[model samples]
Target: MTTALPSGLASAGLNAGEQELLDRVGQVARACAERADHYDRTARFPADDFDDLFAAGLNAPTVPREHGGLGLGPLSRDTLTLWLVTKELAKADLSLGRCWEGHANALVLVDALGSAEQKRRWFDGVVTRGEKWVGWSGEPQAPKPGEKRRFGTSVVRDDGAWVVTGTKVFATSATGAQWAILLVDTEGPGGARHAPDGRDSLLMLACDLSDPSVSVDDSWWDPIGMRATVSHLVRFDGTRLPDANVIGAPGAYLREGWQTAFIPHYAASFLGAAEAAYEYALKYVIRQDKVADPYVQHRVGSMAVDVESAYLWLRHVATLWDTGKREEARLAGSRARHVVEHLALRTVDNCVRVCGARSLIRPSPVERILRDLTFYVRHDNDDQVLATIGRALLGQEHDASFYKP
Candidate 1:
């Protein structure tokens, strides 16, 4: 609604073709919102939604045409395009928007780090063939007591092949996907997996979900929000992956390259969620004509300010993507995520107060938006990001490492 739209966000990073493709994606997602709950209620995958995205050729923007995609090169190409697209889809339905996050991560991996054969072999599957998968963030085996510090899966080299045995608890899209980019234990006797000191390692594996070595047992996914996301346990027995499936050798998984490269792709979903809350609140209050009252106007104005701030912060972060600052992106990612999501909840809560219990009704548009925003605001992973920023301000590497990329 504001001409203040981050200027050139579309043209600078995308071609005319890509812009057209993004428009088509937005249209299709708008149409599919009606059916999102049908799948959500049944705990079924949103196949028709995926079909719509695939038909629109919007599976992953980062994959190259040589591999059968738009070749947009991650969030860097058209940051606003990626931001708007993900937010619009999420407004329609979070589960569908969320599944795309995994696909985007995989695409970034294939484009940024995949070997030539990987591009040759699985590139088309991602773009042209519509191969979809989820990243393994929360999935972990039962870490012995407090061993949650380690990602439970293990990838041990056996002769020329790799054998993987572990369980991914609460793995999203557990039975529906053909591949998973799982984290694994690659620390050797030295325990130096990352710079400075850390015993943990990250491993990204392209595994066969169809093999008997993989079993999806006990779908323990009763949640107050993000329902219909059938996040369950996926167990990997003594399964063998061709050594080629290992990404970036044995020890490079947790470094700045792999982690930072694909991290922001998941964040589009969070930004989208927060935006949904803001948009839903704004529309509800205006439609109800609640703004006529002086108190209501003041409250509505506050919410508008919050909405503007969230998008403004988002576009600022988008600017970072425009500049291609990959190595120093960690703290920026954390701060942007926290700020946008915070504004989302604050905006939604204000709107809910303005709308009263009507906002809390079953399937109330604002109610669902509020729930989604709450969950979005809570996705804090490693607590080191804020700590790192604080340390950098004090010029103390002993406290943390900071990147300026």
Candidate 2:
């Protein structure tokens, strides 16, 4: 039997086409949830979930319609509907949500920075073939105290072709992605360093994962949560590409406001995970005849508030972006993500607290939800996000924005 969303979720400002898409995504979410536990237990990639997505014609919603996509790309003005779709998908499986969001991020980069020819090539592959792409930016190492972080990957001009050599850690969907939109330092060996301002060194390149020089290292990615994401480390050893492969010039990746736009997507997905945990707790309480307890009732009420507040914050930020108030949108997105992160964490904890020990055991959906949501919310730079919001409200502009430029 199919489950229905809350009364207003599909009707809230969505056009008929969008509403239909949301209904279809609901079915996809159910399928994903059914298999989520099995994937988590075995620490295997959720290949079946993606296959289901492809069959549903839900693989490339962000691609342009002319290119066979729904054209709801990240840069599109329709932000609220997209968030709703992301939230539903995440509720079923946070791992797949993370992977799907990465694909959206890649599309945003391509739309903003890719050459026309590059877009035609990659976008057609995505819409026509259900090909998957992922974004890769995490480095394996960090700078020491009092030192700025530098890129570990490098792209250099060699014999009229670009030679890319570097390792990217936490590369989501590496095991299954056909392509990667990677961030690399354009400065070659013995070349000048990136500007201290942190804006001029990075270049975005499209790398074909099927290349002979690309390798996936699955040894380091066994995490406590979101294991089915297969976020393995990827190594590029002198991977060669033509000049046409460069998505954008050095510094173009950060300049397009993609990072700021991505905040809501993460928040929405984590919120969905929190919702899943809360719903499971609700069912368990009623099934066990504990719903009459005042304390249990209070806890559930509080969880409801958290989930609703997250949804509202996400909507506000999406609206702000859709209206083209980009700076305000960025500030709001950071603040909303911060608020939702805390709320999501609290909601999951409340779920466990209300259910007692059974919620912590294997085969219990709450336990898996807790682990996945916990790991997912640990995105870096929380303190910085807070400070950025604080500064914005105080009418003080920091030399740099909270996001990397």
Q: Write candidate 2's Cα lDDT for 1-405 as tens digits.
A: 112235564347778998999899899999999999998887777888878888988888677777777777347787787778788888998988898888877887788788889889999888878889988877635454774534367777888788888777778998888999877767542111222234667667788999999998888788999998888878889999777888877776555556777877899898889889888888888889898799998988888888888888987888888888888887788888889999999999999989999889977888888889889887546777787677767877542233322
Worst 10 residues of 2 by lDDT: 188-197
RMSD of each: 4.4, 3.7
Q: lDDT of all the models against the reference?
A: 0.61, 0.79
- The digit string of per-residue lDDT tens for model 1 on 1-405 reads 432224653335556765777678779887767876575567666777877787877876667665566655434455556666776687777777766666666667656667998777777676666777766646332355645334345668788877777665546667566777765655421112222333235556778678888887644565555554567766778888877887665445444445554344445665555555555656766777765688767766776676566566556666676787654454565566656655666666777777788767866655655665565444443355566566666787622221321
lDDT of 1 at 381: 37
Model 1 worst lDDT window (10 residues): 188-197
Q: How many backbone clashes does candidate 2 have?
A: 0
